[model samples]
Target: MSAAPVIVIGSGLAGLMTALTLAPMPVVLVTAGRLGQAGSSPLAQGGVAAAIGVDDDTSLHLADTLAAGDGLCDAASAREIVGRGRDAIMALESHGVRFDRKPDGSYALGLEAAHSRHRIVHVDGDATGAGIVKALVAKVRETASITILEDCRALRLIKRDDRVVGVCLEGKGPVAARAVVLATGGAGGLYEATTTPLGNLGQGAALAGRVGARLADMEFVQFHPTALAVSAPRLPLISEAVRGEGAILINDRGERFMADQPGQELAPRDVVARAIAAEIDAGRKVYLDARAALGEGFVRRFPGIFALCQEHGIDPARMPIPVRPATHYHMGGIAADCDGRTNVPGLWAVGEAACTGLHGANRLASNSLLEAAVMGLNAGRAIASEMTAATVRLEPVSLPQMSDPAPVRAIVSRGLGILRHETGLRAAICALLPKAGHDDAAAVALAMAVAAFARCESRGSHARTDYPHKNASGTRKLFTMDEAFAFARELAASQPLSRTA
Candidate 1:
């Protein structure tokens, strides 16, 4: 709390880009884990999606994005992000990010699933996330206006008369600021096995709901169809680039299953993931075979995935790598405009935390980094453009204390996981409410429960067998805190009580 003009939560690509874009404006970056430990950005294998190739255009890129989003993408937002993709990539280059280049000295673009062209730009092949993060972190360190506070978790947002003024931290004290940008990433940790950092437990989305911000499409949790199937606590991801390079999805029977699908091995992630889930349920193991497709080039091109696969006793060049669907990204989050403005004034969200209508129902491959860079800069510019020197004094909002996290974790993992049903969801809501009592953890659980209950239809990542049909209209829904609470109460009243405090 050094009287900075802006307080940014999380230090991923979005947070770091936002802070850096607001150069010379005193800003403080607070991270839950070490700056780079809590985000999925650094774990990204495929690169950012941009219209950099001579044959590629924004319209084509937009079409690819909309197609991957399953007809729910906001056309305007998709066009805007796609149009700016090239510029965003160039901006990163200006910030000293070294991308991979071909022998001809131009960017070596790679293809990914659901994209019609070679638009994914990487660095060191599969280490795009690490490379981009490394550059941004270096830039942030040299900037005098940006102060880095590591291992500081945001407990709750501080509000006064519907305007966010600051946030309460777990370890560090409260940070008062003129503007707050949430870039805490996605809710992958809510699942038992996920590719995202273990600390990304949807706190940002929950905090926004508590502060009365509108949340959109919370049901669209995107599960990566090919995370390395291992017993590790945090499952590692085998990049989609492997498939992009011609790897085939096979079952334990040595059958190539993806060939039966529309896009084959390059289908939208949801389709691929659901197919894999079905195969697994049928007692067949899914594998990503890249031996014939990549040969020795696999090791050189994707050293990160190669090393990880090697550590797990699966040689990418020799054997078919075991894979499974794991919670990877959340397509829904706090509803924000293109500039990252939330319903609450002075509160902005970007990257995975903000639903900018870019991803729609499902996110396209490698488009995440592009969104982070573009939206981060947009949010940064928006905050800087509306700078105010008037310091508004505000009373602190009291948060209820919590002692245990086990019960909350269990509730989230069981009820609101990869698969959902009305019975379990209702039971989860009933069990979580009393245990939450009046604590902040309970407040978060309540939001999740409410969101899970509202999305009755099986769409995107939220698969509800009870409500199996996909909503035909594909209309995106946004919920305010009051709406969520009311729905939760209604659902709670209808269900029989299983537990009472």
Candidate 2:
């Protein structure tokens, strides 16, 4: 270490866990808003997936994860992470998290889509994320070794001799660090309708890619099947647990649309989302009906969702709740190892911002929180053991302009929605390439568009209208900003603009 404090950005679950695990070591935790008030961690409705039930084991959990990943997941990585599922749950509890329990004092595990057993450890029913963050925030605030910087945004990375040394903030200029960790969440905000905090615009991937870090699986974006269909800056998510509880998807004509699907409403998210999108595209409105299933028990099972539905003038116990597919998660990000080590020596990433090949093409339900906690703990230990002392002097670094995702949202949403094609992707790349150099959002969007174009087959969440079938063998794609930009330019020249519709 350079004797400077380790700088952790984003203040979400991964960042907080990383800071806490580095206890007794000096750490500076920075966030764009008040701690626990920003990022997607607090908005997660589902609980953490762990194999702690009587009949469940790590092997079964790994099988479900691999199945959802759609043939692209790294089997070794998935097995290792899933094997540590119980340890991650215990680690969170030690930080003051209170998971819900049954009347017998055992853990109350809930079931979600694609799981073989009931293994979701929740807190306060559907408000699991809020409950977890509340306890962790209180614990983090009281810790003596961690320093919290509120309302600070990271603009770029400061590199020296091919190693990342610090981060340049919006107004605080450059802050030197022994090592830097990026946990800035996912790129769902790049879409018009998303369930993430609007500020999460793939900032981690953009910052890492600008400094030559390899980005992986940029084409796979998961769309949640049941975001409450209403006008808002961020859509409210109706948890998959709702469907797990027997709520069926129905059209306005009262026909159960997913009845004939492989798993019906409980299929993998890509299957359900595509089904709903097809219904809406054909001039029919889709809804989730819990009236015949939950009835009076709806509020007790999912109080948070029930309250949100009430706010929108719909009662789940009486009438079906209108819903549509919305961008919920990104399985692609800065490529890293299980310990969060990136291509660059002193840079690390965890949570949704790091693509460790654990999620592959699609993520299993309730697995995001598990990955975040496990990776954060792994990264902290790795950094403490490997970081070395270096004689370094602070240098003045020029901060880039503050990023605006507004200009890139329409292009990303148009070309990178639930269904994609080559023409829309090429058009998106053509428009985004000009702005990518100066705009962080454009840079991230361009990289995703390039990857989507390169992938000529439909697999998992990446459904291509042009190629409607999966290839015999699926391989993960990785890119750097320079490589993506070069490909975009070549593609723009290879075809006429008139070919894009």
For every model shown, what is its TM-score relative to the native structure? 0.95, 0.98
Clashing pairs for model 2 are: 1-388, 1-389
Each candidate's lDDT (Cα)? 0.84, 0.92
| Candidate 2 error regions (>4 Å) | 496-501
24-99 per-residue lDDT for model 1 (tens digits): 8888898877776569888888999998888898889999998888777888988888899978998899888999
Candidate 2 global TM-score: 0.98
| Stretches of candidate 1 exceeding 4 Å from the true structure | 1-4, 394-406, 435-449, 497-501
Weakest 10 consecutive residues, lDDT, candidate 1?
Answer: 435-444
Error of 1 at 339 (Å): 1.0
Predicted structure with the largest lDDT when compared to the true one: 2
Each prediction's total of clashing residue pairs, residues at least 3 apart in sequence or on different chains, is: 0, 2
